[model samples]
Target: MKQFRLHKVASVCLIAAMALIGCSSQGGEKAAPGTQPGASEGSGQQVTLSMHSWRVEDTEGYKAIIQAFEAENPNIKIDFKPFKATEYNTILNTALQSDSGPDILQLRPYAPGISLAEAGYLEPLDNIAGISAFPKDVLAAATGKDGKVYGVPLSLNSTQFFYNKKIFEQNGLKEPKSWDELIATAKTLKEKGIVPISFGAKEGWLLSLSHGVIAPASYSGSGYIDKLLKGESNLQSPEFLQSISRMQELIPYFPENYVGLELNDMRTLFATEKAAMFINGSFELEGLKKLNPDLQLDFFPMPTNDQKAVITTWVDGSYAVNAKSKHKPEALKFMEFMATKKFGELFANQFKRISAVPGVSTDDPLVNKMAELSQSSSTPYLMVVHFAEGKPTTKQALENALQGMYLGKLTPEQVAEEIQKSAATWFPPFKK
Candidate 1:
């Protein structure tokens, strides 16, 4: 069996510092672009490259994936290093500033990726052969303002409701076809002494995610987002305010003291069957399974009043090469491999995620259903995909405002006003 090792964040920093010190001792210079540092074709020289990511939970999955790559390229070894998601941005920024970052790094999607590319921290991959495998919209997440592709798109995530199949069967519940039916079902579940929804508001990000799933249909999904982006509508508009109000409507169905609970608490409640439903991303499927391997689960999109389903989708993140790396040639080789259908299949099969590469399909029935929902009737995740380029990103503003609304410090109207005010401060469209 192929083998790979995982590194903690502190060890990753120490290893990087040691590598740079050893290079100095050898008087090593940065390799020219497109040139291999020490190894060449059949040269028998070994090279090790470091990769950094924010997914500490994906260690096993990445270990297997990296093993496949290492098996194919025997002379190249990769040290897969992952940090806590909450600290990754700061760690990556610090490493980049000191020129001690990993050869390959995971980048946050959209505006954050563009920021790095603009800062010259990432190598441009405009001419990479594998980049042609992705569509223009998918590539947009990692493309810089200068029109250069800076990373390989990894996964497309859909936010929806994951339900406990066993509980639904026991309660004689079927998937809700309309908003009213969904409310009725939640009421029925709550009457039976079961938590209708496993959700928490302690982390501001989770509130934003929950809003993404619950509120899209209220404002009519992409139709309204387009109008908002073009200055035709504002967050304080009636329809948008209704969207915020919808989140408040569902507050009664959430667990007691949910505002004090965090993500892990929410996941535990759902995975252990303490709750009947969970609203989250496609990325959570494997995690839930790991928590309870025997858990019987399925997912569905939130239904609209008109009976249409609306799933919110976004490119989660991507993999990029550090512009300062001495292993540019080998790092590019790995990037090429990541863009291949082979790697795409491995990623989808192992992680149960929706791979961004075109024509890549998953064996997981639930993942397949998510893809179908996305293709049939889906909207872009509004805040991160469009309004995150500005300072006090629309996402952050909405999250904070929602938290305040939940705490009884703000009303739905006030929440909408705060979002509009924050956006107007930096968002060009809103400035109009």
Candidate 2:
């Protein structure tokens, strides 16, 4: 798995009770004492270091790089544990609670990391030498209220609208530039029996992202985002509603099992040619191309009501060391290697996503277009349901609302109420 190959996202029915990551890590070469000034003093000090990361199936892809690290530092060996995509978050939390977890972890920025940071599972990064080179915005992201950095963001992957070039050409359609065009295109695709949009709203968070980033950015104008951030505006403003209303109107244009799909399933449907377009982050490009090398995939800015569409950035992966790790310095060294310009290019060019580091040319024609369209991205971890105890609530409310809307159980006004309730809980103002 060269890129993120999240094969399938199983039903979230058991999400409440299930621990994430079904794979157990075992059977890797182990050694120790080959690293650090003092650790190396003991010639045969064996440290069978095991670590956990989300979606660990990238064994073969990470092979070359990890092997190089191991070869250079002979005494330290790494036992890599891969997490199943569907169960990663829950399992990672469980592992982090116990002292027996992996020494390092791959964390999501907009999720429930504050709990772990406060629990003292994560190490601070203020003194890390290479911290300055990381994306400034993303660097700010890993900083928690405890005044310590919980992680180091590796790449910034923005979300957008992915449409099939061949399909657009065959239908004599151009990429939509405004909300009206998007709706018109959906209507056209519907007549051809193609699902125009593919989002697993049944999973809730994916649907929220579409509504949160694309909808708001398109209708209210970019200034609206800053206003909301400054508390001059709230999500329930007319602009957000207008954009969300347009998104909701497309319920009839998605796949048949829209009520039963999740993120990975929706991507598979698009990759297998079951849908004409998909809206998602950049992590999927490599795996998508692998499935169909000649698919002619091109993404365009999500059509907003505004003349200029604003890009919402989501930094995909963040790396953090364990607070209790005996080898903190080496871990920072690894973080340094990951933050360099070299890693940024490897990430962007390798994964076909936006890079977080400065000075990295997204000069490749396709990547350049994505970069050009990405105006700016900000950090707001305090909001977004995927962040904490708030997720289950959002998932329930959103899943119920969308599923109800699709099934004609809920009215538009009713659905709006349920979403607003959740947003309020997640975005309450600081009371200092």
Candidate 3:
């Protein structure tokens, strides 16, 4: 009877939903609160909380985590919902606006999450237990402009190149340590009839993610974005514009009709051995493995023009509680569990992601190597984080400019000017 009761409770909380707003799936609507199989006979009612995240691939991994959490907190049940990355923000924003949002949500760290917090959609997590143990910089990445703690980071990820080890060996090439060497290496690979890189610009937003990894190392390492935020740097500056032009120079080595392809297609091109390298975040390792379990891969810091490479690192994702959640205590409980070292280890072990907790480290050597590279990460992709929070966001503006460039409709200068102009309402120098 006890076993059956536990299963019932799990079912209530772990219901899979296709659409977040409706909370309905192909399996039908979830069991309503208070009437679920394990609902208390009187005062101790069962509470089911929905957690929406963008990691659809991590669903099974999170289920294992959820099961562990359920065993400890029997009264509260958690349902994990996943969404496509490209459409996640739009769906989540819409849900929050309509008061139909989940109890917990995966937030894009920094400016994007802060924008929601400022709009009063997210709960302040100041009182959550063990939150103080998190690294200050990681915590600050999820903090709102108002100084309130809005989320707890899920993992640290950096944008870098994942190169095929076998491909490098076959070509007798060593990993490039400088920008010039990187170009020369790519040129050599192209001459050998191998696609040097797998990149997809069809979605447009990839320009931000891809370039965010390169721009910092190329221009001024981590200090560049900081300067841009402080009005010390602007998109029109030669250093910043040079990064854009550099991307153009390297474009020829990418898969043909690269802009017409999607990320999955590009990954396929890499996985099948047609491409020698793929630039993405550390989070992509698991997906890449699934595509080709035997494909040997390793990573290197994004090379810089001056040879002093800097990795682009930041708190990639965080979990925020919904301000309007009906079950705040339960939501807090789950988030508190997320902060525990036990949960951190579980997350890293299961998902192969680096934990945000101070003492926790991923057991995976590659993940640890990625962490080592982060020590040099200072400049983040600010337009994605801070500058473009309102009006035409820096991300949107920049991607449009990049798309225009891809189509040969705009020069690098014109693209930069368009980005500045697009962000004019929000960027200080361009404002009236």
TM-scores, each model vs. reference: 0.90, 0.81, 0.87
Question: Which pairs clash in the backbone of model 1?
Answer: none
Top-TM-score candidate index: 1
Show where candidate 1 strays beyond 4 Å. 1-42
Error of 1 at 63 (Å): 1.1
Candidate 2, superposed: residue stretches over 4 Å from native: 1-38, 41-48, 56-59, 362-364, 376-400, 423-426, 430-432
Poorest 10 consecutive residues of model 2 by lDDT? Answer: 5-14
lDDT digits (tens) for residues 386-422 of candidate 1 = 6664576778899999999999999999999988888
Ranked by lDDT, top first: 1, 3, 2
lDDT of 2: 0.60
Q: 280-339, model 3: which lDDT tens digit per residue?
A: 888888778878989998988876766677676667688988977877667777888998
Cα displacement (angstroms), candidate 3, residue 317, comes to 1.6
Tens digit per residue, CA lDDT, model 2, 79-119: 77778765787888777677656777787653455456656
Which regions of candidate 3 fall more than 4 Å away from where they truly are?
Answer: 1-44, 428-432
**Candidate 2 vs 3: which has more lDDT:** 3
Residue pairs that clash (backbone atoms under 3 angstroms), model 2? 20-87, 20-91, 21-87, 34-75, 111-387, 112-387, 218-304, 218-305
